[model samples]
Target chain A: MRETPSLIVRYVARRAVPFIQLYALYVLGHGEDGPGGGFQGGVIFASSFVLLALAYGWGQGRKHVPEKLFDLLAPAGCLLYAGIGFVALLVGGAFLQYEAFVGEGADHATKHHAHHFGLIGIELGVMLTVTASMVILFFEMSRPDEEGAFGDGASQEDVEALHDGSAATEEAPDA
Target chain B: MEVLILAILVGLAVAAVRARDLMASVAILGGYSLMMALLWCQMNALDVGFTEAAVGAGISTVLMLAALGRIGRREVGPTRAPLLRLPLLTMQQRLRRARHLSRQHHRSSAWGAILVCVLVGGALLYGTRDIPQVGASDSPANRAGSLAEYYVTKAPEEVGPANMVTSVLGDYRGYDTMGETVVIFTAALCVLMLLRQARVRRGDERDA
Candidate 1:
């Protein structure tokens, strides 16, 4: 939080985050053709948010993504991934079977299209899970704690207590 | 070209290891990862290269820098010569006064870490001798009976993937990728539990 006091860093990060977030979406959506994938795109997405925190501190970051929402987002991503696979099982096919999604696709081209569609479904799941996880990890590690216990946030009381503890330690040398 | 890249890799690795400042070391590690990403690109593994550049060089570097904030930047000096050295940096001294730290030093621990690094590096170098030749058509990895041939020939016709890696990752090994997503979710949950703050505010009887 102390490291994020620079005006230029906040300015640059604010300007750059939108573009980074946009690229993350592009990478996730157009992943089938390029060097992008769900995991790669997700991490990139998370880093954009992480930049917000690193540049402007947890106060601004928390405003952008509430801590409670982030806690739910991570597990929701994983569940989305598993839900797609479960659909196949419910449709009388082996788990994660793409051919099961083909309802009227009687030909090879149609079948191929179905597989492509299925791949996109899982990719979305991966993107969500990875993005949520990376964001959560960043938020967790970068949190400034009160009692040196790596807590969620630092309160005024914690700061005062910290000062008191330091003062006590300082005076002990003479006593 | 490979030799040049390898030389750069070696140099970066050494630089990363020898760097005294934790922040500087993290920056060097990021550079090293970028080099590895370039090497992967040269080898035509674009997806792997992209992931390496994004995750290892980008996010991991940021994460290291963030984590470094919790701990001391300076490695406590083990040499007795610097024991009495009280740096007279006025600005820094004021900053240090504001932030309290408890430092401990062990020269043997540093030596042990160096020894471990040497052993690991040596073992890796030794293991490289047994590796099959790169890009060899006759090598076990690329032989006629190998799985690579099947994936190359059959994937397009059967799986209909624009990218073979996707075909393999999402279809042939769909379970594996899904498992990876679950792992990511689990990690998120663990971090959440660890970092979540639970506090109970007490009614002040002292004020009354």
Candidate 2:
């Protein structure tokens, strides 16, 4: 009935999760300069949460990062993205046309300011959407079934015991 | 050269369809898409090639894997010719009718008809002498006053991003990208809603 994972395994998982999230952020931030982008980076970042849930159990991860928060943030991110484009439209240019944001002056400084503002806004929107979606997906996938309702909000120890029991059954039959 | 490329494309497509293993078929499809992307690049359609790379190779492969995970991996049986049972007709009459048909006609009557049509269509394409040569600088895509010129010249200055295509897609065509994102969001929401177990309301308790 021993449920807890070994100290070594727990230690490794705890350390690894933060690094994975950081890497995802790096990928998202540098997406324009590199091969990676919002979609790929978001998936990778979300996977870190999935890994955390797998290793430490879903309850702990959910306690740390709630699904409801991501649910709200996901749409908010989309709205933020759309809002930027709407701003451009209101400025007398076509939707998302940055030239309209620039003042009446024909100089490069005006153009550069508009371009910088537009790119930053779009990147922020992408980052928000990607992070929220990934976390939400992981939560949905790892939610407990009715049969395991007894183990709902179960600790990491309980999950380890279940995993070990299944592993033992498979190994015992072969041996 | 174009003929050789077309022949290879045909062979790859056939292999993708006929492969017995689902994983193998998926791999073949990936190869087919990669080849098609390369062909696009060679034809000087870089934008199309970029899109094919992103959607065909990246998204499609992930989707296929996700689907395979949900479905069982093993192939059930060797793919047989679809059974065509004429319930009212006698077996003898069916045999007689099948024998009376020519082999070419029989083959063309089945799914292979589509293949034959495609091959004939390709042959007909060879007769279009007025068609511009591939990657011709004077082609409409490269002609004066074309959109490509504007994209090449103004995109970097206007968007402040070195990647002109990304700028055009994310900024210049932001509305379209926003719509596409909404479509993706809707699809994701639909999948989540359909697959999710119905929630039990408070006070509606039943012991398992």
Best by TM-score: 1
Best by DockQ: 1
Q: lDDT of model 2 at residue B206?
A: 57
**Highest lDDT model number:** 1
Q: Kindly give the number of clashing pairs for every candidate.
A: 0, 0
RMSD of 2: 10.0
Q: Which residue pairs clash in candidate 1?
A: none
* Candidate 1 C-alpha error for residue B87, in Å: 25
> After TM-score superposition, what is the CA distance of residue B99 in candidate 1 from its true location, in Å?
34
First chain of model 2: TM-score? 0.74
lDDT of 2 by residue, B1-208 (tens): 6567778889988776755455556777777787787777777666566546655764465456445434423345533221222354578866766655544355546658888888889888876766777657798887878888788888777667666756766766777767765664565565467545344432245533
lDDT of 1 at B147: 91
Question: What TM-score would every model get versus the actual structure?
Answer: 0.78, 0.62
TM-score per model (chain B): 0.73, 0.62
